[model samples]
Target: IARIAWLSMGLPLEVAATTVDSQCGSSQQATSLGAAMVASGMEDVVMCCGVEMMTRVPLGSNMKDGVPMGESYMQHYQPTSQFMGAAMIAEEYQITRADVDAFGLKSQQNAIRAWEENRFEREIVPIEAPVLDDKGQPTGETRVIARDEGLRATTLESLAKLEPVPGQSIHTAGTSSQVSDGASVVI
Candidate 1:
């Protein structure tokens, strides 16, 4: 994917291109490596980019073939999902669901305000994203994606009503990691 992205952008073919897979921290790892290369005088410039189409490939899909949780891991965690881990952390910290809702509400409010204030205009790189059909195939067309489409209007009351993922004590859809699909490049 890294090589394809580089070639698609018409970058120099001789330049090294590689993919980094650190699970959730892949982007950060890639960015840090790129920065390190530049800082070490090994490269004058670097572009760190990543893409995740969750709709096309849902989370935990790769584990279907077999991603066994090691015994070492079970010794610390309950051998449950990350959502359960989040709930355990919440319990240990005494972070109430109300507290989570308040934080989520504030975040949504701030993001909505930022969009209204045009704070992201300068940083946004408009892209032509494909319009997928019901079967998930591209419709041979595209749509302009110029802003963050993830923002939602939410109130503390609304957020508080969301239930945690089944078997978890906290971390609801409103408070947990949200699904997103997109690619970003940082230079």
Candidate 2:
């Protein structure tokens, strides 16, 4: 997948591929590893990319073996611990449902404005997707998927209708980050 992304972006093969699995900190781990390798004179130039296409591979699917737990650990120890975005953010910031709703609304508005202004053109590489007619025949032309898939125009009233998440009862779908597909590369 890294190779495909690199080639698609016209990046060279001299770039190294490092995959990290630290849940939310996977990319950070990859970056630290890359830095260490360069500091040790293993390679001067490194390309690091972190991708979590939750749509393609849902979280916890890769952890079928289950997480470890024992009597030595308490409060934070569980056989299958998974942290959702809203829960973690709510716990960290003591954010309420109202605050989350407002943030979600702002994100949607900003993302829409950015899309309208083509603010992402420089970073985006348009890929051709097959265009099929109603009869399922392919039109010679292809559709461009240049924008993000998660942004949705929402209102506070609509957001308020959502049920609070379990445990803290602070997070809702509106307040949490969208389940999305994204890829980023650094030189």
> Which structure among the candidates has the greatest lDDT?
1
The whole-model C-alpha lDDT of candidate 1 against the native structure comes to 0.80
Query: Candidate 1, residues 1-187: lDDT per residue as tens digits?
Result: 8998789989899989999977667778899999999999999989898777666543554344543666788788666667777778889999988888888888888989999999988878898889989866899999998987778898777777887777765678887766677666799
Kindly list the per-residue Cα lDDT of model 2 for residues 1-187, writing each as its tens digit: 5667667788667765556666556667677888888899998977776776664444434434533444566466543424355467667888777887888888889999998898988978766677778764788878887778777888999989988655556667666666665666566
RMSD of each: 3.4, 6.1
Provide the lDDT at 85 for model 1. Answer: 72
User: Per-model C-alpha lDDT, please?
Assistant: 0.80, 0.70
Off by over 4 Å in 2: 1-16, 24-42, 56-76, 79-93, 128-143, 166-168
How do the predictions measure up, each by TM-score? Answer: 0.80, 0.62
